[model samples]
Target: MNLVLFDLDNTLLAGDSDYEWGQFLIAKGAVDGPHYEAKNKAFYEDYKTGRLDIYAFLAFALHPLATHTRAQLDAWHAEYMETHVKPMITQTARDLVNKRLDDADLVAIITATNSFVTAPIAREFGIPYLIATDPEEIDGRFTGEVAGTPCFREGKVARLERFLEAHGTHLDRLGSSWFYSDSHNDLPLLEKVQHPIAVDPDTVLHAHALAKNWPVISLRGDQHA
Candidate 1:
């Protein structure tokens, strides 16, 4: 069976979920607005530039989860889904994913954002498989540290390999595979796939996609790249 993978942030959703989550917290007075905004923007810019320090970013990103009770976090996340996340979901993105599902392909979301920020977003997309950074939890409380390799850059490929291997298959075993992403950081898995599609790609990925003759598409636009 063919495998189809999507990058969660700008690829599948119009906005970055992780960054938005932080901003949502700041808006709710859960965090200091100026402080979190600056950090969030800086880290996000670092991410787009391919120089992100994943662990450092995570410690900041997951800190709020550790500070709040699970119940409070859940309540805020529900509001986050409605206020920040839901509007980012576009019709074209949904159609693309649903078509893949209807075609019986193996589909999943692979993201660098911690699962705490991305799990509900994945579920909302109706995609069953998700490979994201895991936040360490003990006794129902977050530790603000990663449980394993963060699914960023090369880590994404490693995690997907493990996931496929566990299913009794590997990347090469799939009849064909497709990875759709927006960031250059996804090049590891994007290059590995038989079909590497760039969706609303950033500068580096756009140039790379052009140089490699790969199809580039944008769900946000009326035209296909």
Candidate 2:
């Protein structure tokens, strides 16, 4: 059996969902527009350069979840799906996912974005498995705390191992394994796979992909591979 992992935010979608979610909230007046956008954009820059402190960013990102009721959050997220996320999805991305679903033994979206934000996106891609950061919850409400390791950078490697362990398998047990990502931040997990594909990658990953002779491809028309 083989494994195929796709990075959700920028790889499968034309844009970054986490950053877009923050923008979405700002547009909806859920957050102080200028203040939130400034911090969100700064964090995104850090992420692109592989300098992000996941904990600090999580604290910022998840706090709004704690302040809102589950019902309200769900309603907003439902609207987010229709307004922000759905438009980000493209036919090429969907086709790539469909191809993997038919060809791979296990296919999952591995993203640093919290499960709350990424779960429905995974379902929209028809991917049955997702490996993402988990936000703490109690009594059907968010606690604005991380449940375990944030699935970012090296944490993605650890999370994938745990996921494989839960299935009584290991990376070595797979006939082949592949990971597709657009960020340099994902280098750790990208390096773990037998095949590391840079999909419309950032400057850093683009250089690394070229140096390592890794195959680079683009699912979105606007991106250069």
Candidate 3:
């Protein structure tokens, strides 16, 4: 059976959910205004160029979960989905995902963003499987620590392997595998797939895809292929 994997941020949504989530928190006063927004934007820039330090960024991004209760976080996230994320869910993304879901044996969204921030977004796309970075929990409260690998860069491959194992399958078992992503940070997993689609790629990933003869597509109205 064929396997299909999607990247959540720029690949599916018109904007970056991780960065927007931080801005959402800052606007709600859950995080420091100037300091948090500055670091958030810096981390986003680092991510675009594939120079992000996942550990440092997570420490900053996940801290709010530790300070707030689950209910409070959920309430805020609901608002986030409504106000910020919903508008970014473009028709192109929805159609692509729906088409893939109808064809693929296994469809999954594997993002570097933590599960707490991206789970609802996955649901919005009507995707059932998600492999995202896990935020640590202690006594039913967030610890602001990573559970395992950060699911960034090479960690995405590791996480995907674990997910396949859980389903009594492996990458080799699939007939054809596809991975769509926008960032160079996802190159590790992207290269592993039989079909590597660069969806609205950044500068580095776009050049790399062009050099490697990978199919370049854009769901944001600028179609390369």
Candidate 4:
């Protein structure tokens, strides 16, 4: 048995998941602000670059939702799925997921995206496990805080270790573990995998991928392997 971990944002989807999520919150009446886009973008950039830990990222991402309850955030997530994510599913990524499902591998999504938003995408792709940062709640209301370690950089490897421990799986025991990502920020986790494939990578990651002699793949037209 093996594990196939995938990154959520540009690796699976076409663009920035957090930005889309913030837009979703604004559209759903969950957050009201003219600065939502700029603020969310800045926070997301920092989080992706590993400057923000899991808790800080969630605190900033869902800070707007702090005015509401967890139930309200859940409902807003539903709207987010329908409004922002339902249509952007990439054929190549979907096909890759379907192949993994067919092979019965333990497919997991490891993303820095908030659990509320990433959960829907995981469900859409029929993934069994999701590792993401959770928003802290007190008496059902968001505290504008995050719970547990953030799933970014080395944090992703830590999250994977915990998940495997709970499931009686080990990193070496996976036999042939693989990870797919597009960000240089994911270098820590990518390096840990036996197979690290850089898919449609950005400038910084692409350069590192080349230097490391890692196999780079693309999901765009006429691209594969």
lDDT of 2 by residue, 1-225 (tens): 799999998899989899999998899898889999999999999888778999999999998899989898899999999888988888888889999999999999999999999999999889999999999999999999999999998899999999999988998888999999999999998888999999999999999999999999998864221
lDDT of 3 at 120: 93
Q: Can you give the lDDT of residue 52 in candidate 1? A: 93
Single out the weakest 10-residue window by summed lDDT for candidate 2: 216-225
For each candidate in turn, the TM-score is 0.96, 0.97, 0.96, 0.88
TM-score of 4: 0.88
Model 3 lDDT-worst window of ten: 216-225
lDDT of 1 by residue, 82-137 (tens): 99988888888988999988875689999998898899998998999999999999
- The C-alpha RMSD of each candidate to the native structure, in angstroms, is 2.4, 2.2, 2.4, 3.0
Poorest stretch of ten by lDDT in candidate 4: 216-225
lDDT values for all models: 0.91, 0.93, 0.92, 0.79
Question: Who wins the lDDT comparison?
Answer: 2
Question: Could you arrange the candidates by lDDT from highest to lowest?
Answer: 2, 3, 1, 4
- Which portions of model 3 miss their true places by more than 4 Å? 222-225
Q: Candidate 1, after superposition: displacement of residue 224 in Å?
A: 18
Give candidate 1 regions above 4 Å deviation.
221-225
lDDT of 1: 0.91
For candidate 2, the clash count comes to: 0
